[model samples]
Target chain A: MARKLYELAHSRAGDKGDVLMLSLIPYEEEMYEKLREQVTADRVKSHLNHIVKGDVIRYEMPNISALQFVCQGALLGGVTTSLGMDTHGKTLSYALLEMEVDL
Target chain B: MLRIGSGAGFSGDRIEPAIELAEKGKLDYLVLECLAERTIALAQKRKKADVMLGYDPLLEKRIRSLLPALLKNNVRLVTNMGAANPIGGAQKIIEIAEELGLKVKVAAVTGDDVLPYVFENADSLLFNPELFETASILSANAYMGVSEIVPALETGADVIITGRVADPSLFLAPMIHHFGWSVDDYDLMAKGTVIGHLLECAGQLTGGYFADPKKKDVNGLAYLGFPLAEVQSDGSALLTKVPGTGGTLTLRTVKEQLLYEVMDPSSYITPDVVADFTTVSLREDREDRILLTGGRGKERPAQLKVSVGYDAGFIGEGEITYAGENAYGRAELAGAIVKERISRNYDEFKVDYIGAISGHRGSFGHQVNPYEVRLRVAGKTFEEDKAQRIGEEVEALYTNGPAGGGGARKFVNEVIGIVSTMVPRTVINAAIKVMEVGQNGKETV
Candidate 1:
């Protein structure tokens, strides 16, 4: 059975201009490889297709057991210009966590 | 080892936690990093309105509240609360110190405002065309490095304030001053920079933003504690917070904050160093304490990034709530009415069913059956009147479309768009001015 990303890991979202940086940390250190394998830029880009309008890039932090997804053109022109209520895209991490994953 | 506490993480952070740190936490320095990317631009707007009003609005309140406890504990303060006016901010601090009958030396680090240089070298700057094009520029500030702040600390000033200096550099400067770390020592700079980054967001490191209810519960959130770091000469630090204060400091909180607002962790660029967050390692030293080590840095970037705030028209917003049966449908209907009513007049229009899909923009799909929902309609337009109309349409729903629509609210904000560009590092120069007040309340500069 497939599981939600939230059940296997935790995440946090931050913004820099129109770019959104979302950090994904697995609940257990052993799950790091699984998250890295299943959670790709394409998967995340498709998962947040509505909110993100540009490219998605991923960076790994093996020592910290985490993956950072840098989503471009994600904030509808970011905090200053975005018409959306969540201008900072702070809630998108939960939205990303809603993606289903094979654990 | 130098014990440094964080008084604030942002411009409008809580004041009581900082007071608590000063009153109890044994510390050498308390850094209150209060500037955000768009904040200086907003401050520029205020400075235009009044010459002396551009600094952080809470400067007086924070200074007044923390002065006694800070002085009593000998905890020197280093903050970027100056916003767009470090000199004015320092003067305000001196005034507050005089009012409290306390002797103090406050140093204001200037030269971050690079509007003139930006205009002179506008064509040469690396522009992000997507963010703005020929808009009226409001403010341009270069992120200064530790070189500017060390002199201020060298003056033996009780407080150091700056404007537009990099957030991590605010914490890194004291380490460079106290430990005598060379700027070229990239590894040490990286290590210190990581320490700065970790403690910069005071409460976040203490689980302020980490609460997930049953999944990731954090206790005492009402009075959440702020973070502090005990730095060793070798560049490793022990991160913790005041005991018995609200919030938990664990590996989970530390992990989350380590990458907060960070992009490309291997090359987290700052004016002082290019810190590699990938090299960092965290260990639980004991209860409420995490020992962090293994941060590395590379040579600093040749050019400094400048944040430019420009006038970007206006944002008009309106929201109305609907509850009871078929609340989502009512809210959706209300949104359709507003969009049909006036969306064609604006350059950009957005309709959001607040409870159903506003935040994710329908990416997560709609809630099956929401008990209540808010209909929000917003737009971007050049004219203020056009912006104001977005809210007017939604408010009309109280009588026209939705039966249960209530609590209508409207807002129109003059939009300021913040974009980034890179300028030669040499174009930026940092200068410091020291102000003092004696116990007798005589002021000197």
Candidate 2:
């Protein structure tokens, strides 16, 4: 169920060129394999066509659990674009938390 | 006489005396020690409660009054009050200074709070599985050395705020910055590092933790007045206390501070140097002052040590005791029975029986006599349910033993499980980005 949810969210996120970085607390190698099986680079690239251009996607597995995703270029012209307003970054962080990942 | 000032970790203590001595008595720098392990945890909780406004408000309130006075007197301030949030602490200081209308350039050295970043890139960051398993890290605070703070000093920062930096770094940074010492200059940096180690604990260098020879008048010593360091451009430093301060600066006090957290006296690694503590020498310089000199250091390591955390398994423990005529035998039998019961019920459980008993010396000056014994059984089960089951079995041991009717029944059961999966470890990795921005215009150190 978690894997399916992660795949759907990841695919949706990938359509917009935003890379998903997954970190598992007390990192387990099995999680990396599970993620690889759930989502592919091509599928993520296809999703990116719906969002923004020049977005870099990255997947990271830190020694800790809990995944992290960096959505570069997705917030272009957003509040963080000026660096004066931190709202855009906060919003994106909140949105990322809302993303569902399949176990 | 060389004048110096030091600050302690508790609250309600004022920095006024330290300030007066620094300004009026011509002291070189003032050192304040704040952050502790528990304090960091508290600050983290408070920060989480209000992310927009970081840290407890009291630190800012007290520091606001001291900033203007310290800046006016030209007494440099170094402290670890930055806790887990140095950047936020720096911003707060900047805000407070701006509010007071004081143009104090504040320099904050970060890269210490790498918990968020490490969590962001855990899988790609860690290579070892065992590193993740054994460590149940709650907080991974990067222990930054002092070299980074030098740039802030060069940038003309009157007040420098930093996160979980080594206690010695606060003192070493000012020496490095003021003397323009090179990183590879092991001898000079080692001398500064020694000065830092001496003054890091504030009152500890004075009579606070010292063993007085007379043992008289030691009880009247106050906690507020701490020791200070007067560092020269020549890379030498002197330790002294403020005038009218209650503490005494003896060779005993200085020696105690030197040996505080040091694991190895010969090779004490600091941000400045791998110092040789064995070569250090000290002498009393008049009343309330001690001269510290002669510390040799080696080159610093290339990488910074980062703390990382991961998950570990759950654990539970329970203890029960038995007492009666054959207390020793009964205790032993009771332990065996309990273990047997647990083994029968649960496949995965660890049990340990620890205690001492006095038995009869059959043929000696004493006739056959029994002694009392206390048996403590502790075990851990992976499953919480299984732990509870084991707890029930241990509790029932008291009523079902050979000495059941008269045996003592005091059992404690604690269930332990992985509530969350996060353990912290220190990893020494390659350098990231190095940019030196100081008053002299950004130059790479």
| Best prediction by DockQ | 1
Clashes of 1: 0
Candidate 1 chain B has its poorest 10 consecutive residues by lDDT at B125-134
Which portions of model 2 miss their true places by more than 4 Å? A1-103, B1-4, B9-25, B37-45, B53-58, B98-101, B116-138, B211-219, B309-445
Model 1 native-contact share: 0.92
Pairs clashing within candidate 1: none
Tell how far residue B193 is off in model 1, in angstroms. Answer: 0.6
Candidate 1 residue spans exceeding 4 A from truth? B126-134, B363-367
Instruction: Residues A20-78, candidate 1: write the lDDT tens digits.
Output: 99999998989999899999999999998887899999999899899999999999877
What docking tier does model 1 reach? high
Fnat, one value per model: 0.92, 0.00
How does chain A of every candidate compare to the true chain A by TM-score? 0.97, 0.40
Predicted complex 2: DockQ:
0.01
CA lDDT, candidate 1, residue B345:
95
Candidate 1 per-residue lDDT, tens place, B1-445, comes to: 9999998998989999999899888989999989988889999999999999899999999999999988888999999999999999999998888878889999999988999987776666636544456467889999998988999999999999999998889888999999998989999999999999888889999988899989999899999989899999999999999899999998888999998999889999999999999999999989899999998899999988899888899999999999999898888888888888888898899988777777877746543677998888889988999888888888888778879889999999988888788888778778889989995565656
Please state the error at residue B151 of candidate 1 in Å: 0.8
CA lDDT of each candidate? Answer: 0.89, 0.52
